[model samples]
Target chain A: MWDYSETVKEHFYNPKNAGAVAEANAVGDVGSISCGDALRLTLKVDADTEIILDAGFQTFGCGSAIASSSALTEMVKGKTLDQALEISNQDIADFLDGLPPEKMHCSVMGREALQAAVADYRGEEWVDDHEEGALVCKCFAIDDVMIRDTIKANNLTTVEEVTNYTKAGGGCSSCHEGIENILAEELAARGETFTPGAVGKKEGFVNLAEKEAAPAKLTGVKRILKIQEILEGLRPALQADGGDVELMDVEGKNIYVKLVGACSGCQMAAMTLGGVQQKMIEELGEFVKVIPESERPVEIAGA
Target chain B: MADIYLDNNATTMCDPEVVAAVQPYFSEQFGNPSSLHNFGNKVGFAIKKARKSIQTILGAEHDSEIIFTSCGSESDSTAILSALKAQPERKEIITTVVEHPAVLTLCEFLETEGYTVHYLKVDNKGRLDLDEYASLLTDQVAVVSVMWANNETGTIFPVEQMAEMADAKGVMFHTDAVQAVGKIPMNLADSKIHMLSLSGHKLHAPKGVGVLYLRRGVRFRPLLRGGHQERGRRAGTENTIGIVGLGKACDLALEHMEYENTEVAKLRDRLQEGILAAVPHSFVTGDPDNRLPNTCNIAFEYIEGEAILLLMNKQGIAASSGSACTSGSLEPSHVMKAMGIPYTAAHGTVRFSLSRYTTPEEIERVIEAVPPIVEQLRKLSPYWGDGGPIENPEEAFAPVYA
Candidate 1:
């Protein structure tokens, strides 16, 4: 069970404004039932004063979601539209004592609704930035822009933290790689380097830890198998470059490969070697050194 | 308010008699079963008696067939691994999509181990296609592990017929009967199922004790290799007190199996009917006619299940949800997903599992408590309007990006 605060429990049980504001001038609805959470915020605001006279919400989610929406309503009341815009999801969570890290998306939903509501009141075109980005998480319908935004705003270095903030990469986690890519890009843009091994911090439901673990510790047959798996995926790309690579032999951390076809004696063979070898090190292990088959002496003949 | 626990499927309250039977073994009778002394001999005899009792409950022809393990997961692992070891040539494993993590996770790991794992999908009602299953039985299939009943929806699988087919094909069959054993009648001696797994806690017994019934004359391999415990099948000293409690619990289950089917089932139906009648956009999940007598899985549209469960928790009512939020799994229950339950309903699925200990008054209390909880959550739901749930619920319930 989630260790919800007493204030959250109180707000969920006795929400200050649980109904829609019928005389509301503007409304904002964010999230949906499919994502396991949704919120609709309706506000009654004075046009001239640009102040929110009253705020009410309808939330479909967990305890924290209801409490977050309820708390959002309470915080926005009597505040000007400009002032309400400043009310961050953190401020709403603060009002409810605090929300669990996993339920932080609930607070983020509240903030989105408030932003949407203010845009609706100003008579401005509400263009969602998320639509511009490619879809990343199909299960939750989360986009790259939303994930990147969450990572930037929170200074999140981990994919799990991004999931907590945006609900991306939470379901099925087929999009974890997508989430990780987005995280890496955002973290890189912020001049922060991502720890590859740390990407697998989230365990249990999905066993991505083994996939994300550094393959540098692998030895012998296991290391060969790992290299073969990575090569299989990279083979097509290599072939598209009028080049192909074969696993000639593996001795210790040194991987000897034979470049075939146009790649065998091409002038750019050194460049290709450097490029493919870099990829191999990144995926397989940092300890791995890729070398041409001709450069290595014949060890154990066929081996 | 008095607490009403209907999440027996997650875990059940230990039977007082079973607890009483185990209390003495914990202190006064505490001895290593492997020790060469009178006290240890007594402990060994107790374990033997427990094994016999479980064997009787399962209707196994021989007591030696029952191998005690730490938990249901271990038993499941042992059986599946044993099958693969026995038939090293066969690279394929057939299982259902809605198996418990014990079986499902293992099968997923097997896929990475260069094994072809075929996950048989279930229909919208959570029933496996027997014809599809029949066609999958080939010479290359090493083992077929299907659960006797689903955990989330309580839908019973046709494991008997599936087992028969697998046996005919020279393939080994294993059933993770963790959720089916105590609630339903079983006669393993009559079935061709090579191995069956059951957890002790599911049948009012204590946790940390489980039984894996491996039929006699079946090719077997041990997952754990150590001291000659569990007839060299599983290693480690027997869980003496836990095993004794399990034995007593099985005795009680055998005595009250009729009551569970009749009285407990009635209460389950009452709870199901009450919600279906009182709550709008609510419907029962899984096959109605073919399910565990003590389980009722209902989905209330327009609202998420974690919210419903939280509100119910405030009222001192306990239940389990298939919602992504409740499980922290990000995806709703696989059983619901396999059944093709839409996002609107799947996120709101709640499971109410009862036991023979459930009373009519507690059922009535739960019935009264649930409707208001649903109403409160619906009031908070954007998809719920004054009339009821919104039209085109699928689209309305989907997450809107901004």
Candidate 2:
């Protein structure tokens, strides 16, 4: 068990304010069933004078989610719309005696609800209200407009932060550079001159840690191979669960497979890895090794 | 609220009698074991008494054989790494993939540094393939470290058989009996095993104390170098209180071994039976028979182990899981992986390690509370929804929605 303090557990169990305010000025709902953790956060903001009112939330997550919701509710209970808007994911995480590093996303759920509530209070809607599109990151329900706006609003600093905040880059990090392109485009559209070298220059010099992190880069590097033949045999097992694995890379001996759609998060990835992937890969020869990245990658635009 | 705790494998509440034994070490006999005075001699005498207490319980023939260390992991590290160091010309080490990380990681590091590591694989039920292990044996292999019982699966490998294999090959053999020592009856003289590691915390003893049994005349090197302590083997000021507690705990374990082997094993089986019956898509992780009397690992599908463990914590039932969700690593257990446990089961695998202190009442509450919590999570599972096919009838057997 992660050491959740007594105070935090008490708050999670007996949250100070939990129910939604009746017909509240701004109702912010941040999680969804599709998402592992979601927050249905409603804010009661003053309309006539545009002042402070009330806040409450319902969260579906581990202690971090409930605690973050309780902490955020306690934070913006009487604060003005703008002040409540300023409460960030980091602030809420810090307030709850801290969350584990990976669950930092729970605090982000709280922050998203706060943002959505603030936007609703301001009588605003998502920029691309209705649009035609393929699911960019089906796992997170993130789309092109949200990804663009996240970059535009947050000045998205890195590809990782995008995944961290928006849950978009997590799925197929394939869209990483594409999102970066959109980020640069949006910056340019705002007339902020886009300097191509700015990306590397700001983090300009190489640090020792970066040098030490070289092994993963070396290991992750893919070598060219006959992808068609590998997929041909691997498709049978993939089709069993209404899912499929595509060979992303073939680096010498190691084969990297991407789990698509439902299969991405399926509990049987080991069966996928060993029962299916390994069996087929090993059938080819003892030399062929499989490195399956089975975790789902949702579209997460880091701000 | 009265919360349930089953995570005994992590660490356990110190035994009351052992606590009473250790209390004096911290206060009345607080002098350093290394101090060169009468007061220190009293502390030294206390340690000597504690060692003798353990020696009596272990049925060890000699006092010098019991080398005290900080913890079971430390003893495992010292024994395995020391064997490698002593037999420098031997560049290969053979061990099961299921050995604890203390020995496993050291072997991995050794493998990276030009030493060959042959990880003998286990079957789906977590049994080591002795033939496979035997095939890997070579004259140049320096050491072999196989755990007496796996911490996660509770599967009992044929340690005596494997140890004899190592002995026949003239390779130094070690067993991390951290979880097994007090739970199982271990006769050091009977087995041909060269080295054995035991943990105190597993048997309700204090945490920072453990034992390393190096059979007489085994080639070894000291992992610690300092002022003479542990007969110049592991050098440091002894954790007097912990050792005393461990010594007392060992005595207790020795006294209760038969009772535990029977009654406690019944309680563990009761838990396993209730969970498998009440919870759908759930099954035990290790071999049903031929295992430790105290451990039961059950996996509840479509749920995370940490979440299950957390809910169990809320109800005051403590158990652990090999679920990757428990730690920063999103990937589930490598032990489960080596055993070919499917990821769905791996994500949901929770280990309930029993002790002499574990009661039938605790098992009853776990049986009542665990099924509902699992049902709550499964109800929300997308696969159980209307759009999904009910491949198994249990998926359709809904626990009347609240």
Candidate 3:
């Protein structure tokens, strides 16, 4: 069983604002039954001041999902459309003390439903469909834009974290590579490195507000030095495993490397290469493709 | 207010008598059965008695057929691996899609190792297609492993007839009878089944002990190779206490088999009928006429299962669900999905498996407790009542699996 907080259990057992809002003018629906969770938020707004007079919700999901939706409803009442829009998925989870990482998608669903409702109130067009960006996870219908946005919002660095936050790559696992690429791009844009398995050690939220204002692009010599530093950091660990790596060349986004010693003909060579690539992308805070020296194209190899 | 446990299909409370039978072995009779001393001789005789009890319950030809293992999963693993090793030429295996994870997971891993596995499908009522089973058997098939009874739906498969069919094809047949062993009667002496597996905890014995009934003349290969235990069929020191507990459980099960079919089944029927009567859009999800006597799986549409379970838990009622949310996965129970149960009902399936210890009063309390819970959750469901948010209700909620 999940280690659910007492507050979550409280909201689950006796949820607040658990019906459609009477005399409601705005309604927003997100998620689908096929996805195993869905939420519909209804709001009664004071037409003049645009204050949410009442907020109610109906959810079809697990205990955490219902609790998240309930907490969202309680948090949004009496707030203006702008103030309500400012409430992130993290705030909803905080209202319930905290949710399991796997159930973080419940809070995301709550946030999406709030956005949909507010957009409905303003008569703005809002599409819950994945048409706005390239679809990444076909199983959950999550798109690349959503995955990137979620990564930025949650400081997600791994495919598993992205799945916990957005339900992408949670099924079939065919789209994990796509999610990883999006995470790399998002991390690059933010000038933040992706650290494999760093989420477990990281605690509390990095002030998301502070993070939003501080991204600076790294380029040219600084970028190359960063890549070399990451490779240098990785050398000791590989050497300990009776394997070693040599930096052969760097061409724009591609970093070519030669595996020496036991690493070259090892059965786990691909996994070792993937780890090297992941570490490079994370440390450099940008997208950098890792190519084995043997797999380098004829033109690149000659150059 | 005592906690009402209706999750017997998952595990059972150890019977007091069985516990008493186990206690003496832990302290007084802690001899190595392999030793030749008088202490070892006494412990070895107790083990013999335990084996005889199991052999009698299964109606096997000899007590030598009973091989004690750690748990049902181990027994299942040993049986399947043994069949493949004994017939190395056959590369294919036939099993049902709705089997316990013990069998299904092993088969999935076997598939990765280049074994051809044919997963037979089940109908909406969770019944197997016999014609499909007969057609799937071929000379290349090593063994056919199907559960005697499904753990999720309590739907019993006709394993005896299926065993005969496999025997005709010169193929081995094994049944994971973990759920069916204590609940139903089985006389393997007249059957062609080469192997059967049963867990101790599923029938009021303590956990950690299980039995694998291997037919007397079957060629076998040991999964664990060390210490010549069970005449070199299995290895490792015996789980003496657990074996004694399981032996007592089987002996008691034989005594209470009639009561299980009559009294426990009546309580089950009362709970099923009461819940269906109290809630609308509710239906049962197994082969009603041909299921285990004490198991009932009901689905309450529109609402999800975890919510209902949480509420029921608040009232000191314990049960299990086939809903995706309850399972750590994103999809509902594979058993429910394979039976073509629609998403509308699949996400809300609840299983209540009773034991011989259940009372009519407890059944009445559950019957009273469930309706209000379902009513409360359905009111919170977006799909409930005149279809609140869905634009095209019929099309949106149409059966996906069917």
lDDT tens readout by residue for model 1, B87-152: 899999999999999999999888968999999998889988888998999999989999998888
User: What would the per-residue lDDT of candidate 1 be over residues A129-224, giving only the tens digit for each residue?
Assistant: 433345677545566777777778878777756665566765567788777767777878989897767447532212223335554476567778
TM-score of 3: 0.77
Model 3 per-residue lDDT tens digits across residues B242-298? 998999999999999999999999899999999999887899998999999989999
Candidate number achieving the greatest lDDT relative to the actual structure: 3
Two-way DockQ contest, 1 vs 3, winner: 1
Show what share of the native A-B interface contacts model 1 retains.
0.63
Task: Report clash pairs, candidate 1.
Answer: none
**If both were scored by DockQ, which would come out higher, candidate 2 or candidate 3?**
3
The parts of candidate 1 lying over 4 Å away from their true place are: A127-303, B393-399
Per-candidate iRMSD: 3.8, 10.0, 5.5
Worst 10 residues of 1 chain B by lDDT: B393-402
Clash count, one per candidate: 0, 31, 2
> What lDDT score goes with residue A17 in model 2?
62
**Model 2 stretches astray by more than 4 angstroms:** A3-99, A105-303, B34-37, B386-402
Model 3 CAPRI rating: acceptable
CA lDDT, candidate 1, residue B387 = 66
